[model samples]
Target: MSQGNYRVAIDIGTTKVCTIIVRKRADHRVEVCGISIVPCDGMSKGMVAESASVTVAIKESVEAAAADAGVEVNAVYTGLTGSHIESKNRWANVPRSEGMRPVTDLDLSAAKKAAGAIDLPDDRRLLHVIPRSYALDGLHGVRNPLGMHTGELHIESHVITGSISKITKLHNAVFDAGVRVSSMVVEPLASADAVLTADEREEGAVLVDVGGGTSDIAVYHDGSVVHTAVIPVGGFQFSNDLSIAFAIDFESAERLKIKHGTAAPELAGMKEEITLHPTTMSQPLTISKREIGQVLKERTSELFRMIQLKLEEPHLADIPTDRIVFTGGGAKLDGFLNIAKYIFQRKVRLASPRGLDGMPEGTNDPAYSAAVGIALWGMRNLPAENHVDERKISHTSENSGTATLANKQTAGALSMIRGWLPKRDKETAGT
Candidate 1:
């Protein structure tokens, strides 16, 4: 394997911190060079509570990954999630500065900069401003307007923001861990990139990543991201539910869920049972698997229902996508997709990273999708960022540098995303 470019991605979830080292081969396929996954402490729902504990968790994961890859890393592309993260569509109309000149990437950059004028609360700051589409004059839905003469260029983009305190806590934790946050990627964005195919993006889709601590959503259409959000509820809730119902330790409960839980209880055998030791007793107790499945089904159903309400509140109920793609650790549970289909009432699919070379054993699962995708995101996006945060970074080009705050006003400019879908149904239709 030729060492072309190697990158590290760190995903800090409520239950664990994972660091992955991926190396791009000469043929452009990525390989898993190393991996480190450790239980996380001092975090809840993606927000860092205790900096010292988070720092330790990050340090251990990165060091373990480095040791395995036989390469020391000083910086990383870190994933962020939580209810604190928000996104919206925004646009900026830049009159051709040159007066009837061919639009270039610079013009596009200016439009993106213009769209950065978001009105965020004092507690929040911009994390990412991705150009969604370009429009020249009145002709719209242009992927790129470069090399074409136009009097004005309109830039529509998706801006992701996070709480100032939450952002700072994450930065401090990584810095204390002896690494720099090169760039920030929304967890759902990375997960979508890794799991979604080109058709999924161009044809419209919603990616639901049920991480350990949060469920991240990325709605894509027209080959770009239109909306992104984070829900604090996640797979942890399932484990918690089981723990309370069976009076077992959290660890034991989680194990039970992974091994036997299902989102569709009717599909499970009611007579099936498993015995486990309770936290307070040396004696083992037998529990019906049917009961466990019922608990899981209820929890997951409630989770999807909440998500549905949020979408409606934002008037995103009509996001143009026929399929709902589920990923993340929770998606690993049996019958999760069936539950999603039951709620969304549209086509549903499971997603994971595809087309990788030398993928490590047990690393190609949906759980690793974001880690793999964020590394790829770091590779493809390092150039568009002219100024990045002053952190040690990889895959940086001389043309790109700092990660600074983009204004909030540009957060919701011109926002229409298009893609393929099953013919709209009257019962549960897309608008």
Candidate 2:
């Protein structure tokens, strides 16, 4: 936490790279100073398949953001996602001292260890172990039991886990970009931090981040992230479908999907058509817009169905219905909300990153939500006393000279995990 006021956050997605800079004011309000987005290459489904290429992409994006913000950033909080991430729920109980004394730090530590002792895959590692609620004796839902008196204490928690390899790759990629990796936050979790309100988390909510190669879902109930998963399908799949259906190159198909695709074909007139330039064919072809919509509908509906099925898991089914918030690039597709409503059988709305000042209007798009959220996350999580000396940070084209900053900072992780815990009502606290 160098007395530096600015923090940087980066989201390296499969299809796009985003960087954002935020300045924390004296009053604790965070302002966005700059943002940059670049089409991603050398990445697939949130994994760095080509490390050098990703390093270059990161370097370019970060430099652009630095220019816009009028300051250089030497370290950043990065976002990670993929199909390998998994989550689970567990509980722990601690007995009070023989005299039924108040809880102590030792008791809390024991509870955390108990909750984290659940079985996990050999190849995975725990990313977050978030406490949801604590019970003292028979009284449940106690938010802060630190000073409470009880014969016994019970804790329920959610544990989020991810592949160690994926995390390593993310770190290496950022390191190669000539910047220190301050933290590695799951993409959906970062997005939730930026967009979802505390009320939404407490009331029960789901955040769906639809990116190019994956759609990450985070379910929050009682102010804790109870479940998180990544579906290996996204906007890129739609583009691939269009390419195969229209006999066009992948680039052309992507352009067509972005410019002309829709989720509902029935809305288009039967006689309506659009001109398409198929790469294999020398002549321009006229295709039915409804036909394009039909293909998109098939794929997008399948995605929605998968999301529904994931939610139907017995453990997550209890979450309330009114708080499903959709964000990310795919959420911007035409008629996506209506399609989501039809499939999810619940109220749905688009969530954009907001509440920050000085961001370009283009940065307000849902496509940039994760990026903006990452920046805000950096602002809140990065230590206020840690600052990178701009003079020491080299602007050289090569990444070989950047020193990896060993981050011993723990505040960001605590704040992120705390945000997921249930909040106590004033009346209940008073009582």
lDDT of 1: 0.74
> Pairing residues by index, what is the TM-score of model 2?
0.85
lDDT of each: 0.74, 0.73
TM-score of each: 0.85, 0.85
lDDT of 1 by residue, 279-368 (tens): 766889798888999999988888988777656645355567777898887788898888888788989888777655545545567877
State the lDDT of candidate 2 residue by residue for 194-267, as single tens digits: 78889888888899998877888888878778788899777778877887788776767776777788887777
